[model samples]
Target: MIRKANLQLLIDREYGIGKHGAKAEFARRLGKQADYISRCLYPAEKKGGKNVGEDFAREIEREFSLPVYAMDQQRLGSDTAKTIDVEGLPAPLAQKIAGYRQVVEVPRYDVAGSMGPGTEPPEMNMVVENMSLDANWVRNNLTYTKIDNLKLISGRGDSMAPTIRSGDAVLVDSGINTVEDDAIYFFLMRGKLQIKRIQRGLDGLTIISDNGQYPPIEVPGEREEDITVLAQIIYWWTGRSF
Candidate 1:
C-alpha cells in the first residue's frame, strides 16, 4: 500500500514552496485542481482532505516518470532525488545522510526575518560564516517542506533554561505562522520578539518558560492581533567554554 506519510514527504520535498517546488505548478502539471491537490497533501478530517486512490497513485508515478510501485515503497521521496549511497540505513535516516555533499548557506537574521539562504545577495554579506547545512538533510530531517524556509535568531534570557540557553542561536522555520501543535516557537508579543513554549489547553493557552524561576503566562484563546507566531524553532546551535 502507498503510505500517506511517504507521499506527503515527497510532495513537500518535490513540490513545496522551497527548493523551487510550487504546489500550483505541480497541480497544473498533473492536470488537477490546486485545491484538490492540497486536500490530498494536507488531508485534514475537519478540512476537505482525501486519500489518493491506487489509480491516482499510479497516475502520479507515471506523471513523474517514477518506476512502477515506487510510491509503495517507504521514503519514496528520498530514493528519487539524485541517487546516492545510503549505507543500509533506514529509509528515514538514510535520506538524511545521502545529502552530505549538498550544502546551502543559512544566513542569520532578525526574529522578524528578512532573509534566508536562497535569497542572499552576494554584496549584502549577511550570510553567517560556517552556517552552511546539508540541503537534503535539512529537507528530510527537519520539516519536510522547509528546505529554504529557515533563519537563525538569537535566543535571549534563560526562560527556556537547559533546553535553550541565553544567547544561543535557534534555527527558526519562517514558514510556520500558526500554532498547529504544542512546541517551542519564536514569536512577537506586544511589539517585541520573544521565544517560548506554547501549549493549548481546554481553558486556554499557556506561554511557558522552561526555567522555573520565570512563571508561565496564560492567554485566553488566541490574541492574533497582539501576538504573532513568527516562526517555529526546528534546531539550535551553541558553543561555549568548560
Candidate 2:
C-alpha cells in the first residue's frame, strides 16, 4: 500500500501528471486504462476502491523509473512510517532523496547593512550564529549553485522600506558579485556595506532604494571597482513591526 500524498507527489514529479493531458499520456505509456490507474493511485476515494497490486506497482516502478517500494513503505499505519528513511532505496535515488531531507547551516553575522541613508559600515565579526534552511529550498530558490557561499545578514534603515523592512534577515549569495539589471545586491561603498537595487546603463550604474524619499545614486560604469559587490540578495525574512 502507498500513502496517497506520497503517491501523488511521486506521480506528479515523475510522470508530470499536473500538466494538461498528462494523466492520459502517462496511462498510454504504461499500456493501462487511465481510470484504472487513477483508482489504484487513490484507493481510499469513493470512486477508487481498488488497491494497487504488487505486479502493477512493480510495472509502474519499471516503466517510470520511480522508487515504488520507497513510496509504498510510506503507507500510513506501517511500522516504519515514523521516519522518512531512504536507506532501502537504490544508491542514486537514496542520495537524491536524502539531499532534500538534509539541512544547510548559513552563517549569520551581527552587522547590519544600511538600506536607506548610508552610514559607516561596521566590520563584520565572526558569525554570530547559524541559521538552518532546508537544502531543497536553498537549492530551488538561490541563483548560485554553491551552498557553502551563502550567508545571512540583517538589514538596517528605512530606505528599502515596504519591500525590505528594517531588521529583516536577508540571504545573500556571496558567489554572485556582479550587477544584474534591476536586481537587489549587497555591496561596499565608501567602506560601508549597503543593500540597493542596481540598474546598469550605458552612462553608469543607478543604485536605487524602494522608498521614494531616498534619491538614486549614479556611478560610472568604468569605475566598477569603486564598489565591491559583496553578494546578491536571494531571500528575505522579516516580522511585522509597529
Candidate 3:
C-alpha cells in the first residue's frame, strides 16, 4: 500500500484540513499539486528516480513554503509489514483462523478383503481397492510456530509482477483490515482467489494490477459473484538471482 500518500491523508484528516488546505493550497500556489505531495510521500512511479531525492525537497522548501525532511528508514516502504492489528474483528473468526498453519491432508490407499474357507473361497475380485484418509496431517504439513492468522500462499499470475511475482510466496493476514486504496489482498470470488490492490469506487471496490498490462477489475459489476476477502497480504518473500 502507498504509505506516504496515506500518511499525508492522515495528516490532513487529523488537522481537519482535508485534502485542500493550507499545505495543499500553498503547494498548489507553488505549482505543486496534491499528487506532487502524494508522490513525494511515496515515489514509486515518479520521474527522476524515487522520492525526488534532495533536489525535489529543496524545490518544495523554496517554493511551497513547506519543510522537507530527509527520507528516513521509517518513511520508506509500505506499512503492511510494519504493523497489522485490526480492531472490531469478530473474536470467533479471529480464533478460527489463528494458528491454522497446518496443511490439511487427504490420504489415498488400496484395501484388500478376502474370505477363505474349506470351500473354494469366492474370488476376492477387487472387492475394495481404494480408501482414503487424512494421515499425519498435523505433524507433517503445516507450521504452527507463529500465533498469527496470516499464512503464505504462492502467487500465480504476472498481474502483480515485480511487486508480487509468480511462484512467489505472499503472506495473507485475515486479521488485517481492508482499506480503500492500493493494498494487496487475497480476495475471493466464487471460491477463486485474486491478489490485487483494493480501489474504492462509486459503487463498490476496484481490483488493480501493478503491471498495467491487465486492466483494473471492478467487483460486482464485471462479476456478479459475491466478493469475500480471504485475507490481506502483509508481506511477500521473493528470491534474488546470484
Q: Pick the candidate with the highest TM-score.
A: 2
How are the candidates ranked when ordered by TM-score, highest leading?
A: 2, 1, 3
Clashing pairs in 1: none
Best by lDDT: 2
The C-alpha stretches of model 3 lying farther than 4 A from their native spots are 1-147, 177-181, 220-225
Look at candidate 2 and tell me the lDDT of residue 196.
89
lDDT of 2 by residue, 63-124 (tens): 76755465466522233534559878999988876655445779998777789755576654
Q: Which tens-of-lDDT digit does each residue in 1-242 have in candidate 1?
A: 24566565556556432333366777788898877766777645546677877887888889888777777876564445576678778988887666454546677864322111111113432544445554565756676235577777677666687778776778888899887789888776764567888897887778888788877888887554466887888877654644
Worst 10 residues of 3 by lDDT: 109-118
lDDT of 3 by residue, 1-242 (tens): 33344345434433332223535764565576765655555556646433545565455445524334422223222222233343566887666555343223222112111111111212332322221111232233333323245354556667777677766655455565554455777665554556777776767777777777877767754453476665677655565444
Report lDDT per candidate: 0.67, 0.73, 0.48
Stretches of model 1 off by over 4 angstroms after superposition: 1-101, 110-130, 222-224
TM-score of 2: 0.58
Better candidate by TM-score, 2 or 3: 2
lDDT score at residue 178, model 1, on the 0-100 scale: 83
